[model samples]
Target: MIRLTGITKQYATKGGMREILKGIDLTIKPGDHVGILGRNGAGKSTLVRVIGGAEPPSSGTVERSMSVSWPLAFTGGFHSRLTGIDNLRFICRIYGVNFDERLAFVKDFSELGSYLYEPVGVYSSGMRARLAFAISMTIDFDCYLIDEVMAVGDDSFRERCKVELFEKRKEKAMLIVSHSHRYLKGTCNRFLLFRDGAITEYEDFEEVYAEYKLLLEEPQKF
Candidate 1:
């Protein structure tokens, strides 16, 4: 089980001090699939970062029963000048794992083909996302924290992602961030809406999604 208690995150904006998360409390059991939704600057990314341990919350605690996967994005840790193959080996070295097996998996799953030998700095954003997803999947984790990575995949890869992530990995907990309602509804079993520096859990995704859409349509009211 993953439990977050009294979590609060504050940021210093030019205008004034802004509270991103105000006393968030949530529990995610094993096998839970959760989608996090919010408008821009609503602190959805911040919440995911805090839970991923990339940033510490201003207050409160996040408790987890199992190891959590890092955010699925190639922008972090990956050296731009390094080739994908080299980076794969590098990541394996960091984890002290045998790269021979997992490296092949990442190579094949990324579908970069011969391009995997090229430096990542020359790769497009879509290519970077694919490599990130491939590496993350090859790594073993009890829970996953994703942020906008799903949107970068192509149609076929997206379908494969649905099968592997939502179907095969149903036993693991997941917290995904995406603006695509179709993707969210198709994968997540529950929803969490972030707004006004707070987080709210909902059983009905459509209801919370509607409220979020309203907030977007009328930003002045929110």
Candidate 2:
């Protein structure tokens, strides 16, 4: 289980401090699969990062009893100077996973071929995304944080990711943030609607989706 209490995130701007998340309190259990819905700049990604421990909240406490993953396909965690293979080795070492055992799987899944031997700085966005996704699958985590890049590569690769993360790891907890309601409808059992630095939870996907559409139509009010 993961619990966040009184979570608030702020960023310094020229004018003053800008608050992204305003006193958010959330909890995620082992089997929870939640989809976060929000418009651009609604702080959905910020909330995910905070929950994943990648970013610190300005004022909050995060308690985690289960292992949590970094946001899927988050290239910021990579070392630009290191080769893809080397980066994978570093990650494996940190997680105490057997690098040799996961090497072939990541290689086959990423399909980077010779590019895997090249520095990550030189890889294109798609290649980086592929490497990130492959490495993520190689490690085991109790909870996975997924942003908008679930459909990272081609259709076939996307299907492979879905199979690996959603099908095979069906029991793992997931927090998915995406603009596509159709995609979330199939993957998530619950919904979180983020608006104006706050969140509203809904157990029914269709109900929240309707509210989200309404929010989209009245962005000025929000």
Candidate 3:
């Protein structure tokens, strides 16, 4: 289970301190599929970062009893100077997983072949995304944090990714934030609408989508 209490995030601006997240409280349990909806810069990603421990909350606590993954398939954390296999070893060390045992899986899944021996700086964006996503699957996380990364590649690759994440990991918890309401409608059971730095939780899809559409049509009013 994961519990966020009084979560708030603030950033320094020329004018003054600007708050992004506003004393939000949330709980995520096993098999909970949560979909987050909000306009750009409305603190949807900010909340995900706070919950995933990528960034700290200004005035709140995040408690986690289960293993929570960082935003799925995030590629920015890799060291450009390091080889793909080197970064894999580093990640495995940090996560206390067996590097040797996981090597075959990553190698086959990423389909990087000999490219894994080359520096990450030389890899293309698509290659890097494939490597990162394969490594993500190496760890058995209790909950996955997904920030608009619905799919990563061509038709067949995307289908494989869907099967691996949504089908194989269906029993696990997921927190998804996406602009595509259709994807969220199919993937999540619980919904959260972010407005004015606050969260409104709902279970019924109709209720959440109705409000989301209203916010979309009149974003300034909300």
Note the Cα lDDT for every prediction shown. 0.84, 0.91, 0.90
lDDT tens digits, residue span 63-164, model 1: 978788888654577789999888888888988888889878887888999878999999888888888888888888889887887677788987777777
Q: What is the overall TM-score of model 1 with all chains considered together? A: 0.93
Better of 1 and 3 by lDDT: 3
lDDT value for model 1: 0.84
Runs of candidate 1 exceeding 4 Å displacement: 220-222
RMSD of each: 1.7, 1.6, 1.7
In terms of lDDT, the poorest run of 10 residues in model 2 is 213-222
**TM-score of every prediction relative to native:** 0.93, 0.94, 0.94
Model 3: lowest-lDDT 10 consecutive positions: 150-159
In candidate 3, how many Å is residue 134 off?
0.5
**If ranked by lDDT, best first, what sequence of candidates would result?**
2, 3, 1
lDDT of 3 by residue, 1-222 (tens): 999999999999987988888899999999999999988889999998988888989998999998889898889889999999999999999999999988999998889999999999999988888888888899999999998885666667667778999999999999999988678988899999999899999998889999998888874631
TM-score computed on alpha carbons, candidate 2: 0.94
Q: Which candidate tops lDDT?
A: 2
lDDT at 158, model 1: 78
- How much is 23 displaced in model 3, in angstroms? 1.2
